[model samples]
Target chain A: MHRIRCPFCGARDETEFAYRGDATKRRPPDDADEDAFFDYVYRRANPKDWHVEWWHHTGGCRRLVKVVRHTVTHEVHWTGWPDQPPSLPDGAP
Target chain B: MAITVRNGVACCLVLARRGFAEVTAERLELSLEPGRATIGAERCCLPIAPGEWLVLEQWRADGGLRMQLEGDAAGLAYVSDQSHGRQVIRVAGPAARDLLGRGCRLDLHPRKCRPGFCAATSIAEYACALVQVDAVPSFDLVVAAGYAESFWLWLTDHAAMFGYRAAIETVDRP
Candidate 1:
């Protein structure tokens, strides 16, 4: 099982966490067109390489954490608070 | 090992507001740092999260766990009595760590989780706040009241392999 290092609770089994989907989505402007809104709401990228995502430490601290992970290897590159910018790996896309 | 179901444990959930960590800690006389617990003669404080703690006290005729907490908080934090909403279980004796490690993910090695160290984690799929109370390696698991029976069943069932006896201890009010 993958171990996620929660910023507040340290490393714990992945069973203690709940995956919260992609963290790279950006909201369209308030007055943006319909297509922009549709893309923002429905479109998602399934990258095979490094990706930014959100995870909730539900069983531990119950905090939201932003994670940089390699989808192919299931390697967690880094984990930080939701308010902080993700520090991507050296060769991360 | 011996599994004791501790009843009547006076508990309180204290949540320090942002910027009130120091005041709360000072008033309660217990450090609220994560992974740490302050155990006194009759009182113990286990860290639950950043600025959050689960305070426990041995039940007494004049025990005012909530009153004492509310008084200490003195408008600096939020305090809620959990005496009736949670149950405390004590697992003591040799082989305690080995039995617990069967389901707990955190390394329960002596060097890693020494006495006074506590964690908010899960055991046997049930969320619990665990604290190592002494050098004997006795551990106190505070779990939701609703899950106490089921958790007890699981604990007793698994504890059979290591040879365990059931016991009860009292400490409670509302």
Candidate 2:
């Protein structure tokens, strides 16, 4: 089981958190075209290496946190608040 | 272990003003930090999340605590009475920590879970708030009313293994 470190609450079991989707997605502008909105909603990248995503500390602090995780290894490299960017180590996937 | 199911306690949910600290210090005289509770004689302030707290008190016939908090939180916070919506369970004994560690993922070792340590996490898959009460190694588990019965059943069933005695009392009794 993966242990996620919450920004407010300390590290807790993965069962306490809910996987929010990819954090890289940005919503299209309000006046953007319909195709742009459709693409923004439907399309997503399923990366294999290091990926940036959002995980909600549902059972703990109940806050949205950004996490950098490896898809294949299931290793969480970094975790922080949603406002902060993921800072990965050198040579990290 | 000894377990007491506290009944008729006054519970309040406090959401502090964003970007500033208020209500807790001015009204309750408790300073809140992340994952720590400030305990007073009759009151305990537990941090539920960022800028939020669950204030529990020993209820009296006059219902003064919630009323006073509502009045004091006019523009500072949003206070909701959770007296009937949540249940407080106190577990104490020499083996209290061991009993709780069964389902609690957070480290319950005395070295890490000293008095005033508090966290909002799940125990046995039920979301609840846990706070260390005193050196007796007592812990107060605040759970929602909806999950109280199931949580109690789970607690009692597991507690039986350690030979626990159950009682009913006020929040301050422990």
- Give me the candidate number with maximum lDDT: 1
- Output the number of the TM-score-best candidate: 2
lDDT of 1 by residue, B14-44 (tens): 9988999888888888775789899998999
Docking class of 2: high
TM-score of each: 0.92, 0.92
Q: lDDT of candidate 1?
A: 0.88
TM-score of chain B of 2: 0.91
How do the residues B90-129 of candidate 2 rate in per-residue lDDT, one tens digit apiece? 9998888888888899898888899999999999998999
Residue-wise C-alpha lDDT for candidate 1, range A1-93, written one tens digit per residue? 788888878888999889989998888899999999998888889999999999988888788889999999999989999889999888777
Q: Could you give candidate 2's per-residue lDDT for residues A1-93 as a string of tens digits?
A: 898888888788899999988888889999999999988899888877888999999898889999998899989989999889788867865
Deviation of model 1 at B8, angstroms? 2.6
